[model samples]
Target: MTETDPVTAAPSGKGLDARLVVRRGSFRLDVELSAAPGDVVALLGPNGAGKTTALRALAGLTPLSEGGRLWLDGVRLDRTPPESRPVGVVFQDYLLFPHLSALDNIAFGPRCRGVPKAEARTQAAAWLERMGLAEFAGTRPRRLSGGQAQRVAVARALATRPRLLLLDEPLAALDARTRLDVRAQLRHHLADFEAVAVLVTHDPLDAMVLADRLVVVEDGRVVQEGGPSDIARGPRTDYIAQLVGLNLYRGEAEGHTVRLEAGPAITTTERLDGPVFVAFPPGAVTLHRDRPSGSSARNLWQCRVAGLETHGDQIRVDLTGELPLAADLTTVATAELGLRPGSSVWATVKAAQTHAYPA
Candidate 1:
């Protein structure tokens, strides 16, 4: 399914339905969003696209300008105060008090919600154990690692027993190595969360791994929304395509005939009709500075090498062809070809390496 596809959900009287309209100067955030119980939705976009603003609106940190509505399980909470709302928010920076222990940090929310101090601590302890942070419960935020702080933040949010959880760039603070481990850990916990979860992230990998659906906001408006795999497979906008960096094409496929809208047509292995998506990985494309003498490859486009960059030992050549595509070349091959920016080149991509699916 594509981003335009309608999502299905189990019948929930009112899980979380909100129309958030916030205006700052001339900039406006007008987003209509809904999620059923047990739904994990990710609000994904680049910086300054209002992903954070939307999350804040749902958490009641920002009031809407042109009227707003927020419902939680049939209850209209727009009129409710922030403290009275059942929403739980974990900020990008784990805002744990420096003086407080990891255990106390997790207990703070429940304590503020009127739970007994001892009971809240007990609850916090259980959550800490679940998050694999029980060993560091006595450690303060200043001493905790980035990944540890993130897990504690999550435990705090979940300890509130909220019907809706809001996570803002939960994994953005960790390094690459830590991110890999934390992402796996976070996915398991999110899967076990019984309530609706909405996370704001710019990382495609985080959105794809952590959530069931992605709601892409651009300049305060929802531009694309869909399941992660589908969006990865068929990106409608150039930004999405560039984010995933895949060669995307929109065309009609009848049986095995796949017509390219921008360049030469080709036959595909899939049988389809109407709107379809064709995608090819960057590594599948072969870059040549000269036009092919003779090749069995079905698709070849004469183009110019727009840019060259090194990814580890492999050189990634960006080609502006009859259609632009990214091609991966070895360091030795790049040195031998002497490929550079503005250099003429030819790109050859095998038909079997290209993939087509319903858009």
Candidate 2:
């Protein structure tokens, strides 16, 4: 649906309900979101999809257009200033002050809110202990590791005692090993938080691990939203399909046969009719240099290799022919078949391996 179209959900007993609309030249963004207390929601999409803009609107960093409204705990917040709102934000880069000690950095927010300096430092000490960074409290930002810096940033945000917490790519700067440890730690902290938390991220794994709900936005509109498992198992768009490593097709179904809009037909075990979707993992696809005559697979197509890439231990071959598809094969099989770009191949998939659901 278009962004201007009304999209809503039943409000929970208490939390956040925001309707944001912002116009920049010819571009416009409109979205409605709701979350109950203790709820964590992740806004996930590609770059330039308005995910960050929505977060900025909630944080009061960006002014809303006419007719926009923001509410938290039954109080209006649309016109409130960022510093005045009961909101806390951890930016993408963490944005820790270079010259301030870790302890001072966490204490700054509370101190600015009129808390006594000694009391603020005491609270900062407690937060640092909670984040397992007490040993580094005296160190500056430049001396802390990526994970340590992120924890300090989170502690700083929490010190404000905000009713709404916002995070933008909270773990984007960490290395792979550090990301795992910090992500687990962050999940624990978020669980203990009693307020509503909204995070902006482009990574699906981060969304699934850190948030209770996923809102998939595209081109300034929310295209799909649900629990992580539901979104992964039943992706509605090609972008999601690619994210979850599944090949997807849209088609008109008649009984068990689904005729694809692009071309060819897929035989599925599901007894669906009318408009439908068919999806299968790349691993379920088998590729061969020559088509087998006695194969039991119900779907087979002649395809040419369009591209190839390594996916962990296996090789993923992109193909184009009757159906644009991706097939995952072992390195041994790839070498034996001389697979490469421009190579001709036959791909087959069993009906039992394909899943079909109503669109």
Candidate 3:
């Protein structure tokens, strides 16, 4: 079945409903998305996953292939020009006119929509004040800081009073410190917005923190769509599992044992009998210098260290052997074990540490 089949039974006519299809050479992007007013949906994926293509389709900046449809507030917009659509787009680079002041840059949108010059400036002033950039109204884009420039871009977008908002990597241009501050501010503004907002981003933390719902796209299709917490706890794809820092495997479960398709079996606390997925965090694994004996842990595997890297405050050990997986250890513990690329070690995990769910 198509992605929109389940949700298209009854169109509410008050929000966004779209089936974006774009074909480029051998690549085809077909993504279905629906959101109500006041809903913030994030399109998240790795590079070349069509996240940006979906965003462009929503903004009417890119034409859709045959059979594609786009509707916002019950209005057909697939054939409408970008300027005629009631959509506001904040590009990755802000795209502010360098010669225009902050106020003029924002006022330009309303003026183009035929609002009187004075009235458009008034609206721009209000947006600038709301965005806490009132004092920088006359400042040029080159003179403003990164966060300030982002706020101005958002204010400019809001000045148009669009029914749908599109942000393409809104924080991609900011520095690390500025990103945190802008992310918080952007979340607050999104919460207050009564329109449908779609954000395109590859950063997992940004998606989790700023969006009310996440749509994980890969290979031009929606791989998963759900709440951030749900996706974090039970990832369906290896890309998502790795993004959330979990070792995931598909297997068939019988009683308490899940036989992995790749070659090993994992003992889980849950009792099920069907195809299932097993997942555990790297922190749940313990590595020993030698084979552990008389251990209460139900799972053990002799592995060879394939690589080592620093992950935050812990050392992440990549292993390959009976069951390839990752384990996290402290630098001191790693030294004590004398672990290196070819070091042999035993890894153990209690049955309770693993989680299994239906495939």
Candidate 4:
């Protein structure tokens, strides 16, 4: 990708365009991101990968060291203060003031921007109604449920009429049930948002459901980015592979065979050569106690079970030997085989079940 100078990039566009570089001590964060109007972009990564720092820089809460510029809807905001920028941020914890009523919390943003008290209250009331929290308008943060508090937080950010919206781990604070309900509601709200929206999340499900595009960041840099389905189908890094639940291996290929540097040769149906990647789902793997005769599976390796754990209705067995693999078996099959940790087993997968692509 060609790197564009953020400072010189034109701001007269429909969305946000930014290049951020932040340095503190020896750590540095560098990333380029863009989103069109009505687009929700998600920054996803592991812990301490600078996803939050990137969001802060975009919100003007964190200053950039150098090579940083921010533009939204034809306005340059690199030098703007956090309060002055047309940006709104919803924090991970939904930092609602304990002393303020829900209506007051939503109205606070507009009031801070110099709107009259009556007008701010009116706008806040409308937002509460839109969020389906009109009845809870007078309730304090302490009385609201987790999902309600999150909605109030989102409403507070939207009440400011920001051109750029940022949400940092918006659903991380909710319980499983609350997260499911709130995620649906947030998706609806984001769909109606007219400006650019960017959210930081480590949850792959949240990112897939809420964002139009996924930006996978690691070690303060963007490693992969694309539509959610594309990223899910073709993960570029092991972190992403783990998120998508695929057993990915990088290897050198010659036609229909790939030789893993880690000491395994996988046969694939795809006609690929040079550097390649082969991936298969855990369910595609079958484990056996004794080598089977007259089996059609092209790939077989003897492995010792490293661990075993429940995966929903199935048991996931982690094996390490010639190849490190994860195999998902039914509970009945696992019980029949008496599978346990450190048990020697054979794993097999057909070439037709394995997917190979250029690395």
Count of clashes, each model: 0, 0, 0, 1
Estimate candidate 3's alpha-carbon lDDT, on a 0 to 1 scale: 0.93
Model 4 ranges off by over 4 Å = 1-6, 9-12
**Cα lDDT, model 2, residue 310:** 96
For model 1, residues 234-305, the per-residue Cα lDDT tens digits are 787667876776877777787777777777765666778877878887888887767887877888888888
State residue 343's C-alpha deviation in candidate 2, in Å.
Answer: 0.7
Q: Against the true structure, whose TM-score is highest?
A: 4
Tens digit of per-residue lDDT, candidate 2, span 72-183: 8877788688889999999989999999999999999999999999999999999999998889989999999999999999999999988999999999999999999999
Residue-level lDDT tens digits of model 4 in 268-289: 9998889988889999999899
Identify the superior model by TM-score, candidate 1 or candidate 2: 2
What shift in Å separates residue 205 of candidate 3 from its native position after superposition? 0.8
What local lDDT score does residue 4 receive in model 2, on the 0 to 100 scale? 42
By summed lDDT, the worst window of 10 consecutive residues in model 3 runs over 1-10
